[model samples]
Target: MPTTHLTPTTVITGFLGSGKTTLLNALLRHPALEDTAVLVNEFGDVGIDHLLVDELDDEAIVLLNAGCLCCTIRNDLVGALSDLRTRRARGEIPPFRRVVIETTGLADPAPILHTLLSHEALTDDFRVDGIVTTVDGLHGERQLDQNIESVKQAAVADRIVLTKTDLAGDTTTLRERLRAINTTASVLEAVSGDIEPAKLLDTGLFNLHDKPPEVTEWLRAVDQDGWSPDNGHHHRHDDGIASFYLEASQPLAIHRFVTWIERLLETEGERVLRLKGVLDVEGSDAPIVVHGVQHVFHPLTQLSRWPDESRRSQIVLIGRELDEHAVRSSFDAAVVG
Candidate 1:
C-alpha cells in the first residue's frame, strides 16, 4: 500500500577537470555501488568501456557490468528522475537503492540541489543523503581564487575529495585553503579516483544494517582544537568565506531551536552554504542531528546515544561573507530568547 524504501541521493560536483567522472567511474565498478543509478551530464564524459557496459534501450540507459545503471541528463533532470522512478515502478529497471547525480565541472550545485528540495515528487520518494565535492589538488587553490563557482562548490560540500594528489606536488596549501572554506566537510585524499565508496555514501542517519564510517569522521571535525563558541579561534578564517563552530553546554529547547533555524534560513539561506550540528535537545536522551544546504533542511535524525564523549550541542556553520560576530551573538540570543 505504501513505499517502504526511501532512496538516498548523493550529488557529486566539482569544477572543470576535478576528476568527478573519474571518481564516478571508479565508484560504478565497486561492488558496493552495484545497486546505484548514476545520472551524469554526458554519457561520453564518463567513457564507460563498451565491453563492460550494455545499452538497455534507445534512451541511452546502460547497465554496467557491476549491475549499476548509467544514464545521461539530456536536458530536464526532473524528467529524467521521474522516468527512472516510473521505470523502477513497472519493473523496467533495476531496483536501485541509491542515486548519484554527477554534475558537470562548470555547473553550480545550488540549483540542482534546489530541485531535489523543492520537487514534491522527488522529495516524497527520496532523501538528500549528502553532497560529495571533488577538488583538484593540483589547481584547487588557483581555482578557488579565480572562479566563484569553484568557491561555491567547495563551500557546499558535505565531503571534499582531493583528486590528483600525486601530481599536486605538496597539497598542504590547497588542503588548508579548502579547510578554511569548509571545516565541517571531511577532506579525503584520492589518487586516480580510488576511494572507499562506503566512506562517501550512507552519510545520513545511522543504520544498524549499514553503519556509516563517517560518523566518527564528522565528530572528529567538530572536536578539533579552538572551535568552541567561547574560543577566539571559533571562526576558521576571514577570507570572505569562513566556517565557525557554536557549542552550547546546555541542552537546546527543540521548538526554539527549530524556530530559530527557520527564521535564519528564511533571511540568510543564500549565504548559509552549509549547516550541520549534533544537538542536545531538551527532554531527549538521544542526540539529534541536523543538516542543511542553503535553505533546504534534511529530516532530523535522533541517535540513541552520543557518538562520542562530548555530549554538548555542537553546530558548524559554513557561509560566504557571513558576519561571524553577529552570527555568534544571534546564536546566543536564539538559544536563550
Candidate 2:
C-alpha cells in the first residue's frame, strides 16, 4: 500500500512563560497527543511543568512518563526533521502521525513557517496544518502593547489558547484584545494548560484520515462581510487591530484568486497577519483552501468536495493597522476582472 497521508505539523507558540510546556504536558497525559512527536526548544533545559519528563536516550530524545516522545532541537531544525523521518521510516522510532513544534517565546513564527513549508526535503512528507498560539490572559494586553512578537503570534494563530485564567486577573479585557487582533482564530481558554487536544490540533481544512472537513467550526468566529472598523468601534482594543470577512457567493476564477493573493502578500505581507479562505473555483467541484502567516504561505490543499451544502467562497483576514477598504476593493476587482 502507498503512503496514505502526509504527517501534519502544528506549532505551539506563545510569549515567554505562557504555559506552552504545561499545555504540552497536559496534552501528553491524555491519549490525544500520544504517538505525536514533539520538537521542543530544549529538553531537560528547564523543569517540566505538569509531569515528570524522563530522559529516555542520550540524543536528548525524552519520553513523558505518560508515553509522549519529545526531542530537543540542537540548532538544526531541518536536520532534526529529516532525521526523525528517517528513524520513523526505518522503524527506529515511533511512527508518529503528527508533529508539534514549540517555539521560544521571543521567536517570530514566520521564519519557522518558511522553513517548514518551503524546504525541499521536508515538504514532500510533512505539511503545516495549524499554529496554536497561547496568550497570557492577565498580561496579554501589556504584551500586545509592548511586544511586537506577542502581537504577531496572536495575529497568525489558528487557535489562540488563553492560559492563566484561573489566576487572579480579569480575562475579559484580554479576550477583547485577542478578538480585535485575530477575529478569525478561535480563542479557547485553558485553566492550567489543559484543553481538549482534538479541538486544538488538525484545525485546517481536513483531518489526517481524510474525513469530511469541519468548515463551520473552522470559520465560526468570522461573519460574512461583517465587523468592519469603519462600522464604529465596538471594543476598546480595536484601536489598531482589525478583523473582517469577505465572501463571494459565486465561484471565482482561479487565476484571479491566485493573483489577488500574490499581490496581497507582495505589497502588504507584514500587515496581512493571518489569512485563511476556502474558495469555490469556477470549474472545479473541489474547494481550494489557502492559509498564510504573514509573508509565508502554506501549501494549498484541495478538498474533495464542499463540506456542507452551501458552495460560497469565504475569506477572513486579521491584521494590524490594515486598510479594510483597500482590501475589500482589491478583492472586488479581482473577482470582477
On a 0 to 1 TM-score scale, where does candidate 1 land against the true structure?
Answer: 0.53
Runs of candidate 2 with Cα error greater than 4 angstroms are 1-4, 42-75, 205-337
The whole-model lDDT of each prediction reads 0.65, 0.64
lDDT against true structure, model 1: 0.65
Minimal lDDT window, size 10, model 1: 63-72
The number of the candidate with the highest lDDT is 1
Clashing pairs in 1: none
Model 1 Cα shift for residue 189 (angstroms): 0.9
